[model samples]
Structure formats: structure tokens, C-alpha cells
Target chain A: MKITIIGSGNAATVLAKLCVQQGHSIVQIISRNEEKGKNLAQNFNAQYIPLNGTVNKNIEIVLVAITDSVFPKALDGLNFGSIPVFHTGGAVSMNVLRNTTTNYGVLYPLQSLSAEVEEIPTIPFLIEANSENSFKILNEFANTLSNNVTKVLEFKRLRLHAAAAIANNFTNYLYTCAKTYCDNEELDFNLLKPLILETANRIQNNDPEKVQTGPAKRQDVYTLGKHLQLFSEYPKLRTLYTRMTESIMHG
Target chain B: MKITIIGSGNAATVLAKLCVQQGHSIVQIISRNEEKGKNLAQNFNAQYIPLNGTVNKNIEIVLVAITDSVFPKALDGLNFGSIPVFHTGGAVSMNVLRNTTTNYGVLYPLQSLSAEVEEIPTIPFLIEANSENSFKILNEFANTLSNNVTKVLEFKRLRLHAAAAIANNFTNYLYTCAKTYCDNEELDFNLLKPLILETANRIQNNDPEKVQTGPAKRQDVYTLGKHLQLFSEYPKLRTLYTRMTESIMHG
Candidate 1:
């Protein structure tokens, strides 16, 4: 497949690398900035083109891997000449591509991605298309890059995206808060690493609520109160601790 | 070391297994129930003694691996004849053993433990003692079971305990909430496993605050609001989502 990848950011870079490694040709690299565009193009052995520049008509798929804010204006004054165009985003609706081209789709990776990672782990790709033919093409292309691919439509995909936010983003925030508390007390944050890994590993084989063990889950009010008092220095964390404990205890 | 292990729960079971594997003699297994006590005792080829029964006077150390609530009453009226005694708990203070015996200490494993797990991973032990002699013995015993051991004091240990609650228990609760939301939508919870593993793995090498991603950290009010709206069907999760988002953004 001859692919043209747009945007020069983390998701874009990772997707481009996956495509090139999988024996697909990256026909062009498009970005608003010429320097980043040229750099990514050189790294992937593709040609550089500005966002407003002409997209190659010979390409098979044009992938837009830009941020949500930039996604709306992604195809402004651009033409793919009936080539299948796919935007990789979780929140945006598939209808946004209705005006871009007759053949448009979405290829959202269900993972918290980072460009610093050299090898992309096996990420589940959630895909959608406006038509069956486009869906088949996009799904086949996605399978080439990842084994875990699902052809979910827009509404269910959005709900899954929201759940992913809570699971990945909210949990990482708690980790940040925990590390902050450890730092303030002059304790080694390193000590909490094994517990964190074990906690995550437990959920692999059991329901998280059933396997929950701690001051909050066991209703150890004495220890919970002590933790609250400790978090008095940070009002936000104190509030968070109270709310989450109540949720766990009551729900 | 001639060791007598008290209780038959997760901590006690793991500790007994570790001691036996290290070629230490389990002099006795003490519990209120004869069945569980004898079961554990027979597993290690040690004598089973009821909580009120006479303990062997020749034992070198008595380890109380019981719940925090029952820890206060664990050694009441039981004479150890100056044998070094230790309890494994995180939130507990070393002073709890002050009235129990003259030679008392703490041997806490800083990891989420389960009785169902057959093999214990390399867990970091947090040890404290009333005196230097007790500390040396406990440290050596702890080193036999685990490579990572720290002699953390009561105050700092309490802080670490609170941080562990947030990192392990609170995050598992968040995972439970996320899984609940996914189940309601008829989505496969298996899709979350890879992301959960990757999120936990990232913190092993980087500062969690620096590597934190998602709508809450980005302060993307639009996606956050959408998630809040989705959670309106479940009031508890809705409240949790709002509080966590605020904490991540403001803290």
C-alpha cells in the first residue's frame, strides 16, 4: 500500500514507522511546519509536503494523525482524488470526514501513545468507515500494523474512548498524586513501583472490585482517617481521597 | 532462625513459606482456629498451637502476621520470654508493640499480597525495631526473603503506607469503575489489559507526573465534559470523574 501520512507528531510518527516497517510505502509526509515535515520524510524515506501542498494522487491511503483541535481543519483546500482518507482520533465524529472525501474513515489506536517509544506495542486499533468498501480496506490495512483491530462504529467507539480516559489517564493522575505525597515525606517513590505493577497485574485475571485490598476497600476507617489527615497539606488530594474512598465504599 | 508464625492469613502464609524456603525452622503456628492453624503448621512441619495455648519457650522469634485491627490483642497475656517479636503491617506504628514485649519490631512487605498467589515476587520489606539488636536480626531475616529491604521509621513508614494506598488500592478502584462503565456499554474489558500494563510499565522508567497523559492532564474541558456527561447514568462514577479531573488539573 502506498500511504501518505499527515502531521509530524507522536501518533503520526509512530503510525508512519509502523507502515514503513510493514513493507508499505510512505508516499508523502505532510505538515504545517517544513522543518519537521522534511525531518520525518527523510527518516521514513518519503517526500515532504506542506499542509496546503498537493497530495499525491498515486497514494492508496492518506492518514491524518493530528490532534483533536487541528483535526477540523485538516483537509482544508486539500484533495485526495478519491483515495481513502482516515483521521486517527478518539473524540471526533466520523461525520467530520463527510465533506473531505467520498471515501473517509477513522483509525483510532486504543492506547496512550508516545513517540519516545521506539517499538509500538500491540495496540488495539478501533476503526470506522463511511462505507463498506472503505471499511474493508481500512480494516485490512490496520491488521497489517496490529493484530488487535476492531471495526467499531462512532457511538460505541466514543464510549470506549471515555472509558479508556478513566482507565489510563485518571489512573496515571493518581500515580502522580501518590508520587507527590511520597516526595513531600522524603520517602522513596521507588518503593511503590512493585505495588503498582502487582495491582495492575491482578486485574488481568480477576475483576478489580473483587480483588480490591486496601484501607478504602476494607473500610479501615482508622487508616483512612490517618491518610486524610496526612493529605491535609494538599487540599486537592485530601478532597480526592475522600471522594474516591466514598465511591469505593458505597458503590 | 527458629521462627513461630502467628495467624494463617495471606501475610502469615507467605512469610511461613519464605522462612521454610530459606531453611529456617518454623517452631510453631498459632491461630484461634485449629483447622487453619494445623493446616498451615502441617504444610511447614511445625507444631500447631491455639491462640490461648502455651507457645514453645525455646523459639527465637515470634512473627505476628495478622490484620491491623486484631494486632493490638495479638500478644495479650501470651508470654514469649523475651523472644524477639515482630508484626507485618504498613499503617501500624512500631509503638503498638511497646506494651506487648520488650523486644518488638515491624517487618512490613511493601507490596500487595494475596494468599492465592503460589510464588511471591521480589517484594521490598520495610523493617523497624525498638532497638539496634532487634533491627539487625529482623533486617537479616528480611534480607533472606527479599533483596530490597529498608529500615524506615514509623512516621515515614506511615507516609509510605498512605502513598501505597493511593498507588495500589485507589488505582484499582478506578480500574473497577472503568470496567463497570465498559461492561454497561457491552464493551470487552479485555481491550483494557494492554493499556493497563503499558501505563504501569511507563512509570517504572519515568516520573509519573512527566509521563502523565489524557484529557484530565491536558485540561481538555470538552472531552472531560463529554466523559462527565456519559457518567451521568452512574452518579457515583460521575462524581469520581469530576473530582479526579479537578485534582489532575489543579494539583
Candidate 2:
């Protein structure tokens, strides 16, 4: 496939690399930033085009990996001439690309990615399309890029996005809270590393509900009170501790 | 060292295995449940004693892995003759064992353990002792069992315990919430596995606060509001989403 990637960011760079490594040609690199655009294009031996420049009609597909705020409009004034277009944002709806081309949908990788990583880990790409033909094209292309590809439509995208936020963002926030507490209490945050790793490992094979273990789950009110008291000085943490404990108890 | 363990639970079983692996002798297995106690003792060719039975005077040390509820009273009138005693619990203070014996402290593994696992992962042992001599003895034994051992005092144990609960229990709850959301929405929870694993892997080398990304951290109000709206029907999850979003926003 002859691909054109618009946006020179982390997701864009990584996806472009994947496409090239999988025997696909990146025909052009389009971006608002000239330096990054040229540098990325230089690596691919592809044409470097400004955001408002003409997109090659010869390209088989277009990958839109820009910011959500400037999306839809960012792909403006450029012509891909009925070539398939795919946006890499998770939150945006597929209909947002309705005006861009005849065949357009979402081609988002469902993992936090960094371009600087020496070896990019396998990312589960969530592909959604407008029609059956477009779905087939996008799904086939996605499978070439990743082994873990799933079709998530617009209806379930936001809900799944929110759940991903809880699983990744909220849990990382909990870790941040715990690390802050350890720092303040003069405890080594390193001590909790093994427990953190085990929690992640255990969930791989077991349901989180079944493997749940703690004071709140066991209704150890004494330990729960003691934990709450320790966080009294930090009211925000105290409330979070209380609310989460209640959530688990009721769960 | 000749050891006598006063429990037949998961922690007790794992700890006994560790002691035996390190060439220590399990002099006896003591528990209120005779069947489990005798069964555990049979594995080591050691005596099985009732919870109220006499402590073997020749045993070098006694390990207490009992529940917090029945503690202190459970040890009432039992005599250990000042041989170093250790309790394996996180939320407990070293002072809790002060009433039971003259030389007693904590010998807790920071990671959650299950006896059924064929190979136990390395657990970071957190040791707290009443005296310098006791600390040395406990730390030495802990070193033989685990490569990761730390000297956490009573002042910091409770705070560390709360942090561990947040790192393990609260994070696992978040995973459960995400999985439940996926199940209700008719989405495959397996798709989020790589994302979950990446979040855990990212935190190993980077600070959680530093690597924090998502709508909450980015102040992407549009996506945050969309997430909250999707979670509105589930009030508890909605509130949790709001609280966590606020936490990341203000963090």
C-alpha cells in the first residue's frame, strides 16, 4: 500500500515506521511543522508537504494522526482524491471524517506510544469504518501493522475510551498518589514495585474482581480506619481512599 | 534455624516453603484447624499442634501469620521463652507483638502470595523489629528468603501499608471497573490488556506523575465531559471518574 501520513507526532511517526517495516510505502509526509515533516520524509524517501499542500493522488491511503482539537479542519483544503482516510484519535467519531473522503474511519492504536522507544511494543489497533468495503480495507491494513487488532465502532468507542481512561489513566493516578504518600512519609517507593508488578501480572490470567484483596474487600474495618487516619493531613488523599474503599466494599 | 509457624493459611504456607528452601527446619505447624495444620506438618515431617497447644521449648523462633482480629487474645498464656518471634502482616505495628513476647517484630512480604503457585515470585520482605539485635536477626533471615528486604520502622509501616493498598487493591478495583464497563457495553475486555500492561511497564522506569497522560492530565475538557456523560447512569463510577479527573487536573 502506498500510504501518506499527515501529522508528525508520536503516533504518526510510530505508525509510519510500522507501515514501512511491513512493506508498505509512505509516499508523502504532511505536517504544519516543516522541520519534523522534512526529517520524517527524509527517512522514508517520501515527499514532504505542508499542511495546506496538495496530497498525492497516487497514494493508496491517508493516515490522519493529528490533534483532536484541530482535526477535520486540519485535513482541510487538501485533496486525496477518494483514497481511504483514517484518523488515529480514539475519542473522535468516524463521522467526523465523513466530508474528507468516500472511505474514511478510525485507525487508532490502543496503547500509549513513544516514538523514542527502541523497540515499539505491539499496539492493539482499534479500527472502525463507515462501510463494509472500507472496513475490510482498514481491517486488513491494521492486521498487517499489528497482531492485536479489533473493530470498535463509533457507538462503543467513547465508552471503551472512558474505560481505557480508568484502566490506564486512573490506575496510574493511583500509583502517583501512592508514590507521593511514600515520598512524604519517608518510605522507599521502591518497596511497592513488586506488589505493583504482581497486581498487573495477576490480572492477565484472573478477573480483577476475583483476585481482589485488601481491607475494604475483606471488610477489615480496623485496618481501613487506620489507613484513613494516616491520610488525615492530606484531605484529598483521605477522601480518595475513603471513596475507593467504599467502591470496593459495595462492588 | 528451627521454626514453628502458628498458621496454616496462604502466607504461612509460602513462608514455611521459603524457610525450608533456605535450609531452616520447620519444627512444628500450629493452628486452630487441626486438619490443615496436620496436613501442612505432614509435608515437613513436623509436629502438628492445636492453637492452644504447648509451644515446643526447643524451637529457635516462632512465626505468627494469624488474622488481625484474633491476635493478642489468641496468644494469651502461650509461652515462647523469649525466642525471636515475628508476625507477617503489613498494616500491623511491631509494637503489637510487644505484649506477646520480649523479642518480637514484623516479618512481612510486601507482595501478595498464593500457595498454589508452582514458583513463587520474589517478594520484597519488610522487616521491623523492637530492638537493634532483633532487627539484625530478622533482617538476616529475611535476606535469605528474598533479595529485596527493607528495614521499615513502626512510624512508617502504617503509611506504607496504606500506599500498598492503593497500589494493589485500588488499582485492581480500577481494572475491575474497566472490565465491567467493557462487559456491559458488549466490548471485549481483552483489547485493553496491552494498554494495561504498558501503563504498568511505563511506571517502572518513569515517575507516574511524569508519565501521566490522558484527558484528565491534558485538561481535555471535551473528552472528560464525554467520559463523565457516558458514565452518568453508573453513579458510583461517574463520581469516581469525576474525583479522579479532578485529582489529575489539580495534581
* Candidate with best TM-score: 1
Winner by DockQ: 1
The alpha-carbon deviation from the true structure for residue B30 of candidate 2, after best TM-score superposition, in angstroms, is: 3.0
Q: Please state the CAPRI-style docking class of candidate 2.
A: medium
For model 2 the TM-score comes to 0.90
Residue range A88-145, candidate 1, lDDT tens digits = 8888887777777789999999888877665576789999998999998999999998
| Deviation in Å, model 2, residue B90 alpha carbon | 1.7
Model 2 lDDT per residue over B1-251, tens place: 99999888778888898899999999999899888899999998889989778768798788998765567666777767678889987887667677667888999888877565445667998888888888888989889899998877766776788899999999999999999988888888888888888887777777888778788887889888888889878888898899889988986
- Specify the poorest-scoring 10-residue window by lDDT in model 1 chain A: A113-122
TM-score list, all predictions: 0.93, 0.90
lDDT of 2 by residue, A143-184 (tens): 999998888777787777889899999999999999998888
Per-residue CA lDDT of model 1 for B52-123, tens digit only, reads 898787888888888776757876877665678898988787777777668889999898877666667668
Backbone clash pairs for candidate 1 read none
Looking at model 1, residue B239 earns an lDDT score of 77
User: What DockQ would you assign to candidate 1?
Assistant: 0.71
Per-candidate chain B TM: 0.91, 0.86
